[model samples]
Target: SSDVVAGYLDAKWNWSTLVGKVNSSTWKAHSVLSTTDATKNNLVGVFYNPTTTTKGNKVFLLAGSLGELNRSGVQRKRENLGLKLVVGDVREPTGSEPSGRIDWAEPTSPLNESTKTAHQGNLTEFLAAGGSGVLTEDGTLVFPLMAENGNGDVYSMMIYSTDNGSNWALSEYMTFAKCYNPRITEWEGSLLMIVDCENGQRVYESRDKGRTWTEAFGKLLGVWAKPRLVFWDVSLHLD
Candidate 1:
């Protein structure tokens, strides 16, 4: 049920490698994002925001480099507190690992119960794409997550903070099943989430700062995976 298509912008400033197979479902239901749905299930995601200080644009996100330590499953519901944020200078070039130019500040601060996600099944299976985390202009933080159960049921969930990581909360799971590698990006002052399926990559939008959502695409688009968006005001877009 894939429809929408998001591509990777090549070095020459051209969008290339346009393959379809990666899209994300926003909830527990097998359906796509709806204009009238709220609540969801499962936890799967990585979030990022450009934190600019006196130094520069510091990209703040949950690093995936420590994959060996972060395991998937029912333990995620409780152990999610172990997840930490890795901050890097946006001025540095992107690389698979944190390098000389880009330094990582792995904060010891963990997420509290008020911000932990609540979902159904054992979300131990890992399934995610881009750091679906973003900081809205209003200073709110949002992270879209995707999780799969042992039985093969896929789940999608949202973790957000209002007081700048002071506390966190999770959204209920929706039946938006069969979607994989969902990626959410900011555009036109709105957050757009794209879900991938065998049929196409579905699109959904959230206004009022990632609280409630609505279906953006009238129809499905394509099947693409591991999607990342290039925002304006940046010289080199790193993931």
Candidate 2:
């Protein structure tokens, strides 16, 4: 009955938000960083590193600022937002020492603060990176990054590492108008990415251990919805 109830509700609602709510509640505090500005929202990604399991379990969170288009007829300026990575020890109830605080080891790119004259309030776009991170059976960590240029076009970069988080290699660039809310899962010895586009859901898969990706399930129903994949012995579950 619990499974049935969960399945029915998950099919109707955004599954990613539900899991995020659960994690947010149990994780004590919202580990992700947010800005004081009402227009800006934090884009976060969480994943568990298995290869480094012996050393210590690490949870990776990345955040960026999103701009809101002004309602006034005058042109509005976009503020430069920064991306921060917060690493925490998953084994312990709370992170140990600096583990709980926000640490800046590296940023995706420098913040961009510029005004949009042509689009004005029409530009409801936000720039965010790092929301989808998934662990593999072989103890590899894979995640996606959102990169935008001066033209406002969005691109995706898949980053992966075999030797834990010590070194990372970048995959080829993916062309997508607007992409966020990345979810990854390993099915039948392969890695799959469920990415959210402005229109609908797009599924990408990798065979060579996440070096690259090809569209597996093209534009599934409910593209705007974010979904998480989980594997169980009995049945495949979505949450």
* TM-score of every model versus the real structure: 0.47, 0.48
- Using lDDT as the measure, the top candidate is 2
Tens-place lDDT per residue, model 1, 5-75, is 12222234323321221232311222111111211243233222212211225544542212112345535
Q: Write the per-residue lDDT of candidate 2 for residues 75-162, one digit (tens) a residue.
A: 6555544333344444322555423332223323222234222322223233344344667777877665555555777655455657
**What's model 1's lDDT at 209?**
50
Total backbone clashes of model 2?
2
Q: What lDDT score is found at residue 21 in candidate 1?
A: 16
**What ranges in model 1 sit over 4 Å off?**
1-57, 65-82, 88-103, 107-128, 173-175, 208-211, 219-239
Each model's lDDT comes to 0.45, 0.46
RMSD to the hidden true structure, all candidates: 15.1, 12.3
TM-score of structure candidate 1: 0.47
